[model samples]
Target: MTGPVSTDRASDEALAELLMRWVPQQRWFAHKSSSAHLQRLERTPLDEGGVAQLVALTVRTGLGDEATSTVYAVPLTVRHAPDEALAGALVGHLPDVDGAEAWVYDGPHDPTFTRALLSLVAAEEGAGSPAFGVHGTSADGGLPVPAGASTKVLGGEQSNTSIVVSAPQGSAEAPLIAKVFRVLSAGDNPDVVVQTALAAAGCERVPRPAGWVDGTWTDPSGATAHGHVAHLTEFLAGSQDAWRVATAAVAAGRPFSEEAGELGAATAEVHAVLARALPTEPATPERLAALADGLRARVAWACTAVPQLHEVAEAATARVDAVRHVTGAPDLQRVHGDYHLGQVLRSAERGWVLLDFEGEPLRPLAERSVPDLALRDVAGMLRSFDYAASSGAASSGAGGEGAGAWAAACCEAFLAAYAAGTGVDPREPGSAAAALLAALELDKALYEVVYEVRNRPDWAHIPLGAVRRLTSPPG
Candidate 1:
């Protein structure tokens, strides 16, 4: 066992300098390209009992005349001895309260932070815990942590850190996966809202809700900001994401219509549950016009970001115009805004389990929380199918025609199943549903073009091809 390092916290000035250099490199930090200055506004400690301390820092970034602040919870672990496992995660050594220099590390990689997190969730208190002002609750009323539970942090997550807690032998509860949100927002996260609602309504299409961590803090301006910091859910062991499954099937030339159909059915089930659990509103002409405007704005922004979108700018506008002029529109309700194959899992026993309802990470929390056209989700899934086809073709060096055929088959089967489950045929031509679906599909493709250009330039052609297909006149 290693000796405990002294508990002297670094001064705010020294910490700010380190964070200024570190924040831009983090995957979850927004505004990376802008030249900005960071200032520490507040720091709250969630845990300081172990070899590490989990501290939530509200940092403000000022760029020119504009300024924005966000809360980030960083775990700073102090160690006197060199830890090989944490060598890569070292933040820097700081002077301890005991006048000894201690090695500090990023908390997520350390077992101390992970273990304390699980212990806190297992305690499951709504108020008055170590995380003062933060509320923690069990989604299923109570989540018992099995004795001798083992902990391991999962890898490759961009926005959040996830730790898996495996139950010991003969435990009643299943394994739990806890997601610690890196960038904090001042509102209830839709992931918690939607999953808890569905779980309460006995919706089996989602993983069982285990618990969540939330809190409120006053900003420097005296405005109170509420944040959902972390969430814990039942872990689905041995489940594979749909992207890997679909792309592999395409690469092997196997038909995926059956699985696609079942996935569509599962999506419809969640939609039905969300409609019942949350507020719903009919889609009026004014609302459709607003939605069209939103798409138009995105297209404009995308054109500015991705120069290739300039060719399709007029075509996208026309499609949005068609949606605005449509006579009747479907009802609007809360939806999975960023629905894609990767957001779903194919479970052997559960069929299909949906994950992540936080919507697009870039959108404001308010907009993401509002009810919207469910067809948006459908459009996103359709785009994913196209992406799978393109990716598989590239990987296997298959002809475009073969990949297109596979995508068409999946789209047809998935839409048919969704229609059957929801009593609305989005594939029906010349109908309001069809018009809305097409417009949303184009919007999603346009969004993808920008995202690909910015993040994965090589993959930009996939969505660019979609833009060309949607815009070109059908023979």
Candidate 2:
């Protein structure tokens, strides 16, 4: 006995109802609290002639307000029989689709989909329906990921799903890792674009990108918008993130100043290369004014979100003014927008390697394309050092007293090395560069305050402390 063929309209309506039930439970879903009324934007078939049909879909997760609505990229394989191998990746059951016994499985976990995903990318094919297109690009001489390769989905990812693909035919073959964007937006996805450029420029600090998928989708307003769908890169073997190494050093009371300095130098080199490789614009007076206002806005937001920030709000805004007064700031360049200990991986072969070129994940996609001061990355690292110290101290029971001094030492060492390479020092307490860095650091801390308040109230103390220390530094 087989179910009747589900008409295209009926299938979409059923799928929309299913998504309303399924998406909220997904880790990649953004709107956890708000009620979602999913509107299918577009659906493109990745592969249609197989036992399982793989389709890529873009859906709007909310209704009415354009600002409130979020777009999501959803890919799934519709098959006749339940794939016990992909049971864990199962999204739900679809009773009818092209007369097959539709059992829907998450795309990344579907072997048929993952295999074709890379092949499409390697072939650099642009395909889709009348309303939208999905394009793929593979680097010159890119190798193929064999069909039915063993793939595993990484756990604990919040915004996207990552799949680790291995060559099942041989153990010696290097593995591949692919990131599929869950939330979709038009324009540049720096994670794909920037890193791919850096890799093509022979930058060793970033993993070499093998291939990527970009897509164009019709919005509710019927405008075709483009953005990256996924990225595939080499999986670094025997690599550990710098956060773990940094924290271990602090926990054991071992000096991390040397490593910090090296990381800073590495960061500076990446910035230099990025500045050379990408577009840059002078920091015009108007841009500076807008920057100051943006900083002040963050401070205001933090003040409202975290009541403790209210007391120092005036002083925080004052730092923004100090930054505004500073003349001849560095030219805006394309650097790692979100640079921190966690975003770096330490490898015995490669040393300090930077990955994830996507700026701040929470920031709007359009804003990320505009180049900005590289000092923002500097401030982000400075904040990361503080978190590392705080965690190490808490774990060791050595208290924030020692942690503060250690963090200060590391910060100073980092700045000193970075300044040596960049020819612009941000270390001196009263210097112009220092003023700008302070303002930027405070803004980042305010961001952390909001994040910690919403996610980890206990950890809010770390950022709150930075906010206070920045506003009123101890003599």
Candidate that scores best on lDDT: 2
In order, candidate lDDTs are 0.78, 0.79
As a TM-score, model 2 comes out at: 0.93
Over 1-475, each residue of candidate 1 has an lDDT whose tens digit, in order, gives 1123232345555655666677678776777776646544344334543355555566666665787766676656656666888889888765542354567678777767666656556676433233324556666653565556777778877777888878877877788888888777788899889888888888988888777878665543557777797888888999998999999988888889999999889989999989999999988889988888888898898889987778888988888778888877778999989899999998899989998889997787888999999999999999999999989888888888999999999999999999998987887778898889988899888888888888899999888998888877644
| lDDT (tens digit, per residue) of candidate 2 on 1-475 | 1112233776766666666677788888887766666555455567544332323344444446743666777777777788798888787787776555577777777777777677677667665644565778886544454445688887877888888888777556568888988877888798987887787777888887788888778665657778888888888868998999989988999889999999989988888888889999988778888899888888887888888788998889898877677777889988788888988999899888898888877688878878899999999999999999999888888878889999999999999999998987997667768888989999999999999999999899999999889999537
TM-score of each: 0.91, 0.93
lDDT of model number 2: 0.79
